[model samples]
Target chain A: MRSNSLTADLQPINKNIRKRFVLSRLHSLAGIVPLGIFMVEHLLTNSTALLGREKYNEQIHLIQSIPFLPLLEIFLVAIPLIFHAGYGIYLSMISKSNTQTYKYERNRLFFFQRVTGITTLVFIIYHVWSFRLAPVFYGTEINFDLVNSHLENVFVFSFYVIGVVGAVFHFSNGIRTGLITWGVTKGPASQRIAQRICLLFFAVFGVLGVTSLFAFI
Target chain B: MSAEKVIRLKVKRKDQMDSESYWEEFAIPYRPNMNVISALMEIQRNPVNAEGTKVRSVAWEYNCLEEVCGACSMRINGKVRQACSTLVEKLEQPIQLEPMETFPVEKDLVVDRQRMFDALQKIKGWIPIDGTYAMGSGPLISSREQQEAYKFSTCMTCGCCLDACPNVNSGSPFIGPQALAQTKYFNMHPTGKLTKNERLEVVIGDEGISNCGNSQNCVEVCPKDIPLTTALAELNHEANRYALWSWLKK
Candidate 1:
């Protein structure tokens, strides 16, 4: 059935193979997307704290109740990351072009984005281990309160502040780039729109994140 | 106000990728109608430095001296541009030549641009037309469409846009602006529309469009002035729509 549906996309012509070849780029790009989407969900869920910690906890618990939770995280989150981080590192090492040709303020942010994206990988594994897997392996109950408790530690909150801020910067830049890649913004007009969006997203993320860290510390 | 002023070419030189790089100044005999490439050719004819010392002729990359080839691109006065179109008279004294950092420097002003081409290959940056050699006229394209395609077609693949892009680097799989613009170009075609969803699928991926910081440097630096950021914005909406629609269909 799968083959039939795919074949219906086009005939067995060589063009079809070429189509698949082009489409296969998604495999590489997908490396960044699954995690990115989860982040959007994460932000929306966490933003509930604007109402109070109780609302945030209620949302978190509700999400945890989703069926097959463990498998979903393993496949959806872990698998995409394997590709995003692995190929990302491989590409960097063997890459011939380094895009740091310009040193504008925005360019500096881009440099930071690459550096942060790489480090974020390490932060993520530790995050997953400490948050998700540690409780399971040690047979301890973990929940939203535990996350809040982690924030109570100075080092832990510091780590969260850095990681989440870096991630927000990275993902907002993605939205800006997405506008360009998708043709939503173009010419000088799009440039203005992108600038506004970049600033807005970053500010929103920065405020929410900093506020959370402050509460924890 | 002086018309006969000479354009001093300060050429940055190296033997190979592994060789140490050094700067050599060559105040070549300048003329009224001269470009940076013409200035270099004058030095090529006589391999002598500004100090009148004999040295090995500088090595650089160029095919079609016309900007269409995109080979003779380099930094003139700290900006990425085609050496061919850069008028020497308007340039500041001591016109500098540096390789675009978008690729690995192979030597002097020559850098490895294989990755840009490879990205094109990875994105299958071409449309398939092999169905029937004797096939009739291809699909008709509107004038407006032709106007847009013409912008993408002007991409000399010079690596200039990549050079200007912040996300493009040895470390990031982010294919940079030129590739994403190319993806949009082909996808915009009538026949190319058949592969539209597939192209978007590639672009919306990790190393694809999302890595761009949207500084709009590519648009500013592009010699042909291709509307790059606009294409990227459109793709964002498409991807969002596609993901939602596909999930609904499922």
Candidate 2:
């Protein structure tokens, strides 16, 4: 009877054991590696706007002029992102939040991580469509003036602000949890230090990304 | 203080596994140095509701009145803990008691913790030694390793970690943190190291380490103060390395 109940309970999870482990690790790896690196590079590139229009445009042009830029974006940025976001959505769906009862800081953060992941995913989809895909299909040049015009609308500006902050929060918090997930920070003290470092990263990059948005305005 | 000082309790009760749950209040005369168990024993003795009528006695399981047995673990005042250790004086008025929702309640506060035991069986959470014949001394261990292992060794199979964990629930197949930490504990043994890969295989499986969301609540609610998250993080490293090595071998 015990075995029967146990098997019934575990039957849903028994299939593709090795595959799940590999995919889960790959999901974590993809987030921190390609997707995380892209966010950093993207933010730093945008922050070039603080150096003035020509510098920002020059950076964009330099990026655009790279040999096989589309391939690099597709393989490095797009695919990892698709997997991360897709798997992340599935993970979020499976996870049941108990923050109401547990009320621990990490438990609350765990709930927020899923929230920000979905938020960031939605924001990225729309942002990419507006700025990257639409520009390519419509033969519009992506320059300083283009971004400046887009941010001119208050609603668009607000959306960008929300999206940027959500994305930053997702990335920063992801690093903190990822450190634990990957076993880099073993103890609570080490985990706390990692959290502080990640928070510092969030504050610095959050200010930089938001300031860059203001730069375009 | 009045001699009539009473300790009020609001207990969430269920008659059976399928029965709907209801609240029953009890007012027992306050006693000095009374823990939740003694208060519960008082309730068992009286079996009367606050409305002053006789009722069936509340059913719960407990043994080794000390915290070590872990059978008396339940939600006391909204926190999952061993009822034996929680003092009445430290708690607020009309203390709330509920069975852990993570497990199926058998009746009242009695939950079927069979899943936790099943997980232990799945991970082979023990050192395999042939005891048929008297064997010589196994191996020597440095005190440093012993001290680290001793921390995890204190776990008493309490369900508090699972109750606290957001990722662990009836709907989820996650083996939860207790089994995961025990896997680490067993693997640390000299004899158990021989089967480390076998355990890692389970650890990397569907209901294994991958299911952990790293919320760190398991470590927070553990009665033994076991560094559960530390074990989890270490296991993650072990499982990852094992997965990578196997992948490379293929």
Candidate 3:
């Protein structure tokens, strides 16, 4: 018998499994839907540098020219990232990393997920601050030279490299786990297939991110 | 001031399965060396609240008054433990008691722990044998194996591990530490290995070992001090190998 009446005076205990299911599903969806898409768009836009300096500047101008840019940033990128990062931090805080206790592959992956999540959040903040906000606040022209000047600093370039790698792992590993958590891949064979697909994703995106980083050089 | 000391207890109570639960505070004459179960018994006798009103007797369950049997497991001072072992003298004042949330409360303090048992069944947590007819001497187990198995054998199915596990909440389908440890125990036995692949199949799935978030809280609250996290770790490794083997065979 599923008792629906369990209560704690201080906290309202959730007896509904559906609420938890929805929250978990939403957390996984947020990782993919807009956040992952945003990463793709950001990388593709930056890759315009490979074509020419003018092409890269034009791409940046095109993004700046979009109607209601601030609104789109808020609704599409910032909000979803905040939600994803906030919920992800909460999950990491509650989770106990047992890599020391359990040296299994999945156990290590679980620990790595939390580590990369924290790094990714820090990287994303640093990236947005340096690239997006600093230019507006400093009243500097947004151009390929600005991007190249920032990448000229060794430390700044290192941060981008590490951040890009962290983002790739987080996104790729997240997809593999999301497939399982959502019940999309239930068996070992299906999970292996999903893992291979995620690895391929990591490879493709890793190349794009690294290529974009080098384009600024 | 000529007054008698009183024990204050706040218990979460529900009359029926679907009814809303309410908190009721009770004050009983302080008895020296009394445990939570004893105070609960006093409440049963008096059936009065701290508000100076008559109330229904608080319902609870118990079998062995000692730590064994595991039937009297409940939240004592917000920590899931066996009520029989928690001394009211040792607990902080205004002892807060609640039913374990991981299971459905069948009454005020008693919960239906059938899910844990169901998980045990799913893992085939017992040794398989042909019949009760006397077989000759069983396969020899090393002293180390026996010692390791003994630790897991002490698990009373108390549900404390599940209660402390963040991953084993009602919404999740995690089979929890208790059953996972038990699965390892049985799988270690000579005869139990006959069905090792069957047990491994259950754990390699979504509801099995994969669901464990490795919170490590389960090991801390285990009444018997079973190496739950260690067993889960070992089981995870074993399950991985078994999964690959199955895939290759397929």
* Model 1: DockQ vs. true structure: 0.17
Q: Write the per-residue lDDT of candidate 2 for residues A138-170, one digit (tens) a residue.
A: 999999999999999999999899899989999
The digit string of per-residue lDDT tens for model 2 on B1-250 reads 5579899999999999999999999999998999999999999999998999998888888999889998999999899999999999999979999999899999999998988998887877778776698778889988999999999888888799999888887566799999999999999999889878878888989888888998888988999999999999999989889888877887
TM-score of 1: 0.64
Which pairs clash in model 3? none
Better of 2 and 3 by DockQ: 2
lDDT of 3 by residue, B1-250 (tens): 7799999999999898788889999999998999999999999999999998999899999999989899989988778899999999999989999998678887788789998877777777778665679777779999999998999999999899888676677456677889888889999999998878777766665567766664457776788888776677677667656765666776
Between prediction 1 and prediction 3, the one with superior lDDT is: 3
Residue ranges of candidate 1 with Cα displaced over 4 Å: A1-34, A44-68, A91-99, A104-112, A139-149, A179-195, B1-8, B14-22, B27-38, B41-47, B56-71, B77-79, B87-94, B99-146, B149-218, B228-250
**Model 1, A1-217: lDDT tens per residue?**
2231222232222333233223433433553478778876776777776666677678877988999998888788888778767755643454333345455655555456567777678778888888778988997665556777787888887888888887787677756554444445656665667768788988897778667656533
RMSD per model, one decimal: 8.0, 2.8, 12.3
lDDT of 3 by residue, A122-185 (tens): 9989888887899789988988998899899999899889899889989888888776554466
Ranking by DockQ: 2, 1, 3
Error of 3 at A33 (Å): 24
